[model samples]
Target: MKITQIEIYAIHLPLIEPFIISYDRYDTMPSIIVKMTTDTGVIGYGESVPDDHVTGESWESTYAVLKHQLAPAVIGQNPMEFEKIHEVMNKVIRDVPAAKAAIDIACFDIAGKTLQVPVYQLIGGRFHKKFPITHVLSIGSPEKMANEAAEHVEMGYRSFKMKVGTEVMKDVERIKAVRERVGADIAIRVDVNQGWVNASTTLRGLRAMRDLDIDWLEQPVKADDIDAMVEIKSKADVSLMIDEGLHGVKEMREIIAKRAADKVNIKLMKCGGIYPAMKLAVMAEMAGIECQVGSMVESSVGSAAGFHVAFSKKNMTSVELTGPLKFSKDIGDLHYEVPFIELNEKPGLGVTVDEAILEELCKFKDVVKEG
Candidate 1:
């Protein structure tokens, strides 16, 4: 079916809680919602969260670009031409990756519904029904972060990804203190959000935390410096996962081929959507590298979409589906009440959005070619 219309919404919603990562604090999701309508009357929904610091995409810029530029490119194209659409959108627009990702996912959802199958099954059948989620504790004092880690552990979470960037000593000290409280059995992953100035500093901090047993050091240095990344990966004994470095499938392959990283963290918003994320997952798997799926602290819409990717990939490693937990308040009750979601017998992605929550949480709605 042809995609007849593209709907773009500028959603302004407050975060239930302020989420502090390495670079900055996010008071709201500051995301753009994309809706694509097909000639056959199928509808698909997608969302993109732009990282002002990391991705350089803002709400006004994404809305203007999508409405003025990208939307016209695929107006009459086949709805399933995600790859072609992706290429056209990228070539036309400069670097609106987050906006591109929203459209990509909307198209995928449409294709999945058109075929009467879930998005995961469309990619390849099923992988696993349920995935164990990891919690991302916001950046705070060492004791506060540690206490938060301990609290999540009490709630049955086995993995925790903490934000570390501001003060290197504090970041290292927090890990050490938290590890002391949580003990050796629990997995502790650290994301620096590209805080290190150089590889030497990254190595120095990593060296200090060596005995604390960090599960993985994420994007410790800048994303562009492949030389530094590969070098860091080679020298460090700890596992290294690249986040900001992933520009596209080719870069991911290059890193994996060169052993630039021990693991790869694929985010739906960052990679432009599920199409590339799944491709990266399969590619990483073939090359004997492990990939973990994460998100941009979006609402249930984005989180649910990510769950499908994480759940459907068998070669998938640990899941970083922490948005639901990171948010002070989540929009929907849909995640909790789904059939076959009991880790078995789940036929599809195992998620459906709650209409009431959608109405309540959304500050504004953008409808394209509304029926």
Candidate 2:
């Protein structure tokens, strides 16, 4: 089928608590959603994590990128021709891969619907009913963070992800407190978000974290310093999963070849859509790198796409698609009102948006376009 139309929306879903990181504070998540319609009556959906902080996308930028850069290339092309679309997107906007990725996700959704299969099947993963979800614990005093972890666990969550990147000793002290509170056996991982001091300190800190059973340390150093990353990887005993170091298939292969990291956290926005996501997974598999699917702060529409991608990867080492749980409110019917994002057995992503809710909770009415 051929594409007939494209629709974009700037969505803002408020978080229960302000999600903070070294980069920015996210009180309300903003994202660009793309919906494409084909001649044969199939509709595919996609979401983009804008470049800026707080949903990382603004309406103006999203529209300009979509209408002028991304949409133009894919308007009339066949959805099956993902390579051509990928090339077109990359050719037009070399660095803004997130915008290109949004359209790519919609194309993949359309492809799966047309082929009468779930998106995961196309990527070679069996459709499991539910995947274990890990809650995100913000950086705070060890006591406060531990309490939060305990609360989620009391609510039935068994896994926890903690944010670090502050001071090294302080980070270690907090992890120690959390480990003491949780009393071991629960999988705990630390996401430093590139907080380590330098290559030397990173090696020293990682050696300590390894002894603590950190499970994984994500992007412990600056993303660009692969040499530093490799040095840290060489010294650390725990698994080092690279988040910022991985972009797409090209960088994925490079990281594996260089041994810069042992695993990767594949964000939907980072990979740009399921097409590259699947491509990256295949590339990772060939190179022996385990993949983990993750998300930006998104409502169910965007979050479910990530879930499917994560569920479909056979070599999925760990997951971080817990955006829905961390946020205070969700904006659509695409999700069940539960603490965790549960997977369904329906066809084609298995969820739908509540337009009325979108109208009330979303920032942009329908399309993310220029004035």
Candidate 3:
């Protein structure tokens, strides 16, 4: 079936609390949601939560691209031709992965619904029906961070991702306190969001937390600095996972060639959507690099897409799709059992969207159909 109409919504979802990282703070997440209606009466959904600091995209730009370029490009095209759809999007514009991701996700959703299988089956089948989720702790004081970890532990969460990349010694203390509070059994990872800015500071930070048993350190330096990543990996005892530094396959190849990182964080927003994300996971598996499916603090519509990717791939050893947990309300249904997110057997992303809720949350809306 061919896609006939695409609806775009610009929404602002309030976070339960202010989410602060090394570079920015957010009390609300702005996202662009896409609704694709096909000729045979099948409908599909997608969401794009762009981060200017991460994907070099913002809500306005993402919405603009979806309405003016990507949505129109996909009209009248077959939803099953995922590769061709991506090629057309790339030709229309470049580097707005978040914008392209929305259309891509919607396309996958329609394909899955039409094929009568889940999105995971289309990719690689389900290796994990339910995976452990790493609840992200925003940047805070040592005591505060430790307390938050303890609280999540009491809630049955066993894995935690702590935000760092502030002061080196203080960041060390923050991890130390959380480790002490959570004990040795709980899994703890760190994400700097490229806060260190250089090899020396990252090395110093890694050295200070050498004995803390951090599962891995993520993106300590800037995104483009492959040389610094190589230097930090060579000098430090910590395992590095590149997040901000990785986007497409080219960057993945560079990271693999340089031995810059032990792991890679694949977010749909970073690499476009499920289609390219699966490719990245395969490339990482070939390179023997473990993968983590990360989120851009999306609602259930987006997080469900990520969960499918994380569950389908064997190499996606870690998951951080806890964005739904951070939001007070969502437009889709997702089941969260503290540390794990479970998926249903419904076709496509397997998410049921509440259109009324979506309308309520939308700040702007537009429809793109054939003229």
User: Tens-digit lDDT track for model 1 on 112-143?
Assistant: 77777777776776677566667787889899
Supply the global lDDT for candidate 3: 0.91
User: How close to the true structure is residue 256 of candidate 2, measured as C-alpha lDDT?
Assistant: 77
* Top TM-score prediction, candidate number: 3
Instruction: For each candidate in turn, give its C-alpha RMSD to the true structure in angstroms.
Output: 3.0, 2.9, 0.9
lDDT of 2: 0.73
In candidate 2, what are the lDDT values of residues 158-187, reduced to their tens digit? 778888888887888888888877877887
Model 1: weakest 10-residue lDDT segment is 337-346
Q: Which ten-residue region of model 3 has the weakest summed lDDT?
A: 334-343
Model 1: runs farther than 4 Å from truth? 328-371
> After TM-score superposition, what is the CA distance of residue 214 in candidate 2 from its true location, in Å?
1.4
Give the whole-model CA lDDT for all candidates, comma-separated: 0.75, 0.73, 0.91
lDDT of 1 at 355: 48
| Higher-TM-score candidate of 1 and 3 | 3
Pairs in steric clash, model 3: none
Q: Give the TM-score of candidate 2.
A: 0.90
lDDT of 3 at 253: 92
Q: TM-scores of all models?
A: 0.90, 0.90, 0.98
The parts of candidate 2 lying over 4 Å away from their true place are: 51-60, 125-129, 207-211, 334-342, 365-371
